[model samples]
Target chain A: MGRTWTLIRRRLLQAIPVILIVSIGIFGLLELAGGDAVDAYLAVTGGGDPAFAERLRQQWGLDAGLWVRFLAYVESLVTLDFGWSVVMSKPVSVAILERLPNTALMMGAAIAFSACLGTLLGGIAALRKGTAADAGITVGALVLNAMPSFWIGLIAIVVFAVKLAWFPLGGIASFDRPDLAIGRVLDVAWHLVLPVTVLGLAYMALYVRLMRSAMIETAASDWVRAARARGLPRLRIVRRHMARPALLPVVTMLGLQAGNLLGGSVVVETVFAIPGLGSLAYDAVSQRDLPLIAGILLVGTLMVIVVNLLVDITYARLDPRVTDDRVRAGGA
Target chain B: MLKVRDLAIRFAGRSASEAGTLAVDGIDLDLDRAQVLALIGESGSGKSATMLALAGLLPKSAKTTGSVLLDDRSILHLDEREKSTVRGRRIGMIFQDPGGSLNPVLTVGDQIDEVVRTHRRLDRRAARAETVSLLSRVGIGDPAARARAYPHQLSGGLKQRVAIAAALAAQPTVILADEPTTALDATVQAQILDLLVNLVQVEHVALLLVTHDLAVAAAVADRIAVMYAGKIVERRGPEQLVTDPGHPYSRALGQAALPFVAAGDGRHAALPELPGRMAEAGGTACAFAPRCPLAIDRCRAQVPPVVPFGDGEAACFRAGETAQ
Candidate 1:
């Protein structure tokens, strides 16, 4: 337990510089893109005079040199100030914070659903390898893996929400029932169903294929054979001896898929019109809101880094052969 | 006593004409308590297949027909469930590489504890204590510390000793060790062989040791069964077989194991090395005839039958004749 904490601490310390560099990179790229916040503000608030635009650039520090502006961005990040969003007319940090929880809720449920269901189904397929079940799952996962999340989301909304009327078409809730908290919560859950399913299905397909191959390989390992030779119960051998090692790959896949899910959320949230970071990122990109874009990029990068770090730790825990030193070297 | 009668194995997905279809063909032997029988042969000689047959550990594609009678009860016909009960409880198997055979994540003590718990009704505490004692019995020094160590943490010989400890946990009447020391260094091989020999005596268990090394079989085995082309060419007491091998294959094997200075003799000069690949099963005549130095027309025309010779058996046509 202490070892795990020490590893976590070491990883977190390493991540500090990576996050700093990523933040700098995001700001530098935005600066190089040559879209001053003054122009975006002018485009949003109707035409303004050149003198007013120059004053706005000076106010937002957009007129400063690239290095001076990047240092200022880093300085603000240290104080948890992500600057103000010229388009949203709110602090960038506040805008991101408002949207983060919704994205977290959708992604959290989606990942949990995919990881669990995929592992169970994949394990079954591997155990029944070369049989009809294995063929069915392999083909099904392949087909689903090829389909885009946005297309799947559109089709799901058409089928279940519009055609069958089983779910609401869009938004966080039935806006009329906001006064009743329970009803509002249930309505929001009902709204989440479509977006979560769309994001989850693509990940589930990859996980099934990844987990099936891993399970088959692990089952054929010498340790599993030894367990059988020792006369351990067949189920016990499958569960304890085989499953744990097989799951090592799945844990790694989970971390890799975390980034994909965030990318996936952009399309899913747009389709469902959910007030999440994905839609916020999309809007910021279209409006060229540099501060908001930089803010979301930082958050997204931090989330991915944290998730991958957790995956490494979990992988090390699963296979004793994996040590903190190896994970550090490999991660680097 | 473990009596193996006419034990033959033909793996599935192959007809009689298919090459390498039959792994073990019509093998018969008996092992008494405290006796060690080594199935000696080169790679692809079906020595390991014969041992795997006894414990029902052969792949599902294998079709085995014959009787493996353990104390008068036939085990060959038992289904998977019943056969599992026989394994570990009645017959324990030790695979080729000790390092690969044990789970890397599990501690040595955890592995032995599991074996004891599976075969017996011991509580967790008692099982742990039993594991420690079992480790000690296998000649592992500092058994307590060794028990907590994983397979990778231990040396190859120590890992082998731990594997032996796991097999002994069942207190099985018979133990099948398939090239147990093949992956170890020369010094470690000797230590592991000593441990196996000591366990066979101290536990009074019938051990079927399979190996490709004649030296290994000669050093540890009481009785040696030399197999060639999926058939036992000779089965005899160690001393008799080493001194006066009735079969040409056994004599060639012995000569191959001889030191450099003793390589020449007037009658058996230029030690005859067997030629050609092992004959596939269902051949009309002796499988070794194609490689035998003493092969004649009749030797290829008919299958050699096991003929008794001085308290042992050999399947050579001219058994009593000295090679010239």
Candidate 2:
């Protein structure tokens, strides 16, 4: 337990610099791209009353130096109090928190679906290597992997939502009556069908291919042969000896893929019109809502860091060879 | 007691035009309880294939036709489940490469414990205790600590000891050690051989030692069976086979075993080399006839039956003439 804690601590320390650099660079690029928020606001409001713009600028501390603004942003982040949104006229943190659960729901469902389906397919393919079933799976995974996520999402909507009338085509839920209970949950799931399936299919294809190769490689290892020679049952041999090491590489790939899901979700979310962070960020960009955009960026960065930390801890537990001290040092 | 009678194994080639090759053709062997038999042959002599067939570990494509009887029960007809029960419990096997045979990730204790658990109904803790005792029995000091170490942490000699310990975990009636010391250094090889010989003696287990080296076979085998192609061409006590070889192949192997002598010693005659390789054994009349300098017209067309000798057997038509 003590060792595990040490590893976690080391990983956290290492992530600090990465988070800082990424946030700083993203914040700088967004600021430079949008120009001064106060000046942009003044122009948008038709240069009406220089006095009102001046007062607004003073109240928001928009006149401060760039370094001062950066420090203020960092301070607000540490205090868990991101400033009010300039365009939406609401707290940025509140808006982000509202949309977070929806994104989490989609990502969690996609991961669970991909892992279960991919592993089963991969295991079956490995057991039947060189057979028609194996060749079909290999070719299918290649085709699925090549399909673009946005295009897949649109096609899913056309086939299942519009054509079949099986699911809702857009929006997280029926906007007429918003409820967080079972009925509303089903409604949201209906809307989630296109995006989640598109993302999951792509991820499943890649994972299946990786897992199939890993299983095949491990099946040929001498240790596996030794296990078979011991007269162990076939199922036991596959489960105990073959599966464990085969899954090691998959664990690392899954961790990296989890990070990618958040980044890559943007296209899928746009095609489905889901009110998640991706859609929120897209809206903020077009409207020049710097405060909302910055808030979304920070949230995305933090989520990625948290997911990485969880992966490191999970890896340490799964593989005994990965000690806490090494994890901590490596994480650093 | 164990007996392998008329054992033959053939494998189909990639094409129909090519005849199926016979790896082991009509070989016979007998081993009494607590007896040690050495099967000596070079690589590709079907020695390993015969051993695997006897153990019921042959590949799916291999076609074996024989009666491998363990105390009158024919093992060739047993199902996989029945064969497995007989394998680890009745006939334990130590493979050629100890390093490759043992699982690297597993602790030495865990590996041994698995064997005990598979054949017996001991709880985990008791099985572990038994594993430690087995390790200590194999001459490993600090058995408890050693049991916790992985295969890679142990030296080559220690790994072989672990393999022996695992093989002995079920208190098997017969132990098949296939080239057990082939990969070890000279001193380590001697120690491992001594350990095996001692364990077999103490356990009163029938030992089938397989090796290509005549010296290794001579070290511990009570009876030596010189295998040519797939058949045992000569079977006798070690001393008789070494000092008074009957078949030409055995005579050639014995002469080759003579130690190298100095260049100036006229008494040290030049070592005689065998004429040809072990022929492609395809249910041939006599596998060694192509390679034998003593081959006659009849040798090519007829398979020689085993002729009885004093407490042994030799398969050669000219055994009567060669005996004198």
Candidate 3:
């Protein structure tokens, strides 16, 4: 437990610098792109007076040099204040927080769904290695990975929503739900079925393949062989001996694919009509809303850091060697 | 007691007629309670294969035939469930590569406790108690604390001790130790081997120690079986096997290994070397004939029959001949 805490502390400290660098990078890149909310607003109006545009830019501090504006943005961020969203006419934080639950619910369910099912199928493939079952799983996972996320989402929506009419076309929920808490929860869950399936399928194949290869490699280790020699039952060996080590790679991939999952959401959320970070970022980018995009990037980057920290914590818990003083000292 | 009769194993996935598939082709061995039988051979010589067969630890692709009798019951013919019950309970295992031979994530105590809980009908607390005691018996100091330590925390010697402790957790009737001390330092190696020998004597368990070093085999094993080209070429009492090897390959192995044991001075003579590669398995000729210094025209044409030599057996037509 002490070791776990130490790891968490170290990882948290490491994430601080990364977060700052990413903020600076996003700020610089957006600055270099030569646009702001004022330009976007002027475009909507078909034209504007030069003084009026200058005043609008001055109000938002976009007229200031890069360093001055960046320092102000950083100051506000330090106090948890994301700048105002000109497009939404609200604080960027408020607008993002409003839709966060929907996205969180969808992403959480997708990760859980893919990880659980992928681990199960992968274990089966390893146990049935060199057989028809293994080959089918290996190839099927490859095929799933090969297809684009949008394609999978489209097909899922068509089959489950358009044809079967089992789920809604797309959205967070329907209007007909009872006012009861469980009813609202169930309604949201019901609406989430297609989106989660589509999102989960996008990464499930990669998870399956990673997990399959990790388990096969783990099963080949001398310890696994020693477990069998100890006369442990086959299932016991697979579950207790092989599974934990095999899970390390899967967890690592989950962290590695965090960016990909966020990228995947751009398509899945748009198709499902869920106003998550992906759609939020897409709108922010197109409308040239710098503060809102910065807020979204902050959230996305933080999420990746959190995911990696979780991976580190898990590695420490799963593998005791990770906590050794030499390893902790970064002695390779 | 363990009695193996005409034990033959062929690797799975490879066809029966495929070359290199028959890893152990028709070998017989015997070990009684409290005796150690060392199966010594070079790499690819089927000693490890023989150990795997005894424990029923071979992979699904390994096709084992013939009968391996433990007491009176046939081990080879047992179903998977029965094999599990008999293994770990009746026969413990100590593998080579002490560092990697134990589960890396698990604490040493947990590894042993699992075997105890599996083989014996013990509760978790009782099994844990047994684990600590087993560790002490394997010569680990501060056994209680050591039990909680993971494999990575321990030195190579201590890891091997933990492995030995795990093997002894279930009070097995037989132990299959495959080069158990190969990875340890010389001093630590001696201690591990001593502990293994002490276990066989104190616990009255039959032990089969597999290694490639004939000197190590001769040091502790009551009897040494010299394997060559996937077959046992000679089995003799250690003293006789070392000083007067019956088979030509055993003699070569003895020559290669004897310098460390016999030569008192630091400077050593050049060791005699075997001349040729091992023959492929599916032939009607002696596997060692090509490498045998005493090989004759007849040796390459026929499989040498097993003949009594110095109270043991050797499968060589000119087993004792000194020169070509």
Candidate 4:
């Protein structure tokens, strides 16, 4: 456990510069793009005088040089200030905090759905390799991989939500719910079903392939061969000896795909009309809401870095040799 | 005792005639308690296949035709589950590389404990006790502490000891060591081989040792069988085979075997080397005839018949004839 913390602490420290560079990169790119709070405001309302735009730029410190503005932004970050969102007319932190949970909840559900069902399918495919079931699952994941999240979400909404009327069309909850808090939770889940499915399909497809190949390769490994020679029951061999080690690759892929999954949610969230960070990020981009965009990027980067840290911890747990290797490399 | 009669193994190809390699052709052997029979051969010679065949460990593509009587029960045709019951309980198997043979994530103790609990049906506490004791029996120090260590944490010799411990957990009557010391260094190799030899004697387990190294086999085996192209060319006591092999292939193997040179033979002399590699199995005539120096037209026209030479047999038409 102490080893895990040490690893996490080192990774987090390493992430500090990466996070700063990403934030500054975004800030610099926005500066180079010749956009500020005033241009975005004028782009929306139109007919703003040059003097008014200048006043607003100066007020927001957008008129400062890139480094000077970035320094101010970093200093504010120390006090947990992400600047004010000219588009949302609120503090950037407040705007992001309000929607962070929604995106987290959606992504958490999607990952949960993918990890469970994907592993199950991949395991079946691997165990019964070269069979019809393996071909069917492999083909199915391929089909899912080819489709876009928006297309999947549209199809799902058309089928399950609109045609069958089993779920609400979109949003976080049924506004006219006359039941208790538990009913609201159920309504939220019902609303979530389509969006989560859409967001999860691509990653689920990825995991299916990863886990299948991993399990196939892992089953062929020397230890698995040893397990079989020991007369371990076939299921026990698959579960403990094969699948457990096979999970390492899948876990690594989870961390690597965290950012991609969040990026995917932008389309899925907009399609389903969920009030999550992704949809917010979409609006933030169109309005050139630099503070809000920068805020989301920082948070997104941190989430990905943290997820990777968790993956490292999981990797160590699943394969103890990883810990020993790290120690051998002088606590690297 | 484990009696194997007319054991043969053939692997099917993608199609009917793509490969059809007879990996282990018809062979017969007897293994009694406390005896070591080493099947020595080169790579692709089917010596390893013979051991894997007895354990029913060959994949589905390989066709095995044999009668394996394990403690008087015919087990050649048994299903996987049924064979598993006989595998760990009646015939234990140790692979060449101990580190590879043990699961990396699991502690060596748990690995041994799993086998003990599986066959013995012992509860956790009792199984753990047996595991530690077995570890100690295999010459591991601080058995309790060592039990908690994973395969990666232990040295090569220690890992081999753990592999031996796992093999001996069920008190199997027959133990198959498939080049059990090949992956270790010279010093560790000898230590593991000695441990296996000692265990076979003390535990009274029938050992079917497989190796490509005739010297290693000669050092430990009571009887040695030299296989060429999926067929055992000669079977005899290790000493006799090393000194005066009946089959030409056995004689070549004896000369080729390293580190166990005959007492009177000049080690520095130009040793006559065997020509060519092992042939792919499946042919009408003698498999070794192409490489055998004593091959005549008849040796090529027909498969050599097993001829009795002293107390053992050699599958050579020219058996008992001295080769120039």
Candidate number of the best TM-score: 4
Winning model by DockQ: 3
Model 1 per-residue lDDT tens digits across residues A192-276: 9888887887889878988899889989997788777788889888887777778988998899899889999999999999999
What is the lDDT, from 0 to 100, of the residue A28 in candidate 1? 71
Per-residue lDDT of A237-294 in model 4, one digit per residue for the tens?
8888888888888888888888898999899889999999999999998888887998
CAPRI class assigned to model 2: acceptable
lDDT of 4 by residue, B1-324 (tens): 688898899888789868678888888888899999999988899888888888878888888897888778897888988988877888889998888888888888888888898889999999999999999999988999999998899998899899888888988899999989889899988888898889889999999999988889989999988888888889999878877789988877777764336435544645667787666676889888888788899988988888888658998889867666
For candidate 1 chain A, which ten residues in a row score worst on lDDT?
A323-332
Which tens-of-lDDT digit does each residue in A79-128 have in candidate 3? 98998998888999998998777877888788889888888889899889
* DockQ: the better of candidates 1 and 2: 1
Query: Taking the candidates in order, what DockQ does each have?
Result: 0.66, 0.32, 0.78, 0.68
Q: Return the interface RMSD of model 1.
A: 1.2
- CA lDDT of each prediction against the hidden true structure: 0.85, 0.79, 0.85, 0.85
Better-scoring candidate (DockQ), 1 or 4: 4
TM-score, chain B, each candidate: 0.94, 0.91, 0.95, 0.95
> Could you tell which candidate, 2 or 4, scores higher by TM-score?
4
What order do you get sorting by DockQ, best first? 3, 4, 1, 2
Cα lDDT tens digits for candidate 3, B49-152 = 88988888777778888889898889886778999878888899998899887888889898889999888889999998988888888888999999999998
Off by over 4 Å in 1: A44-52, A173-190, A324-332, B14-20, B264-272
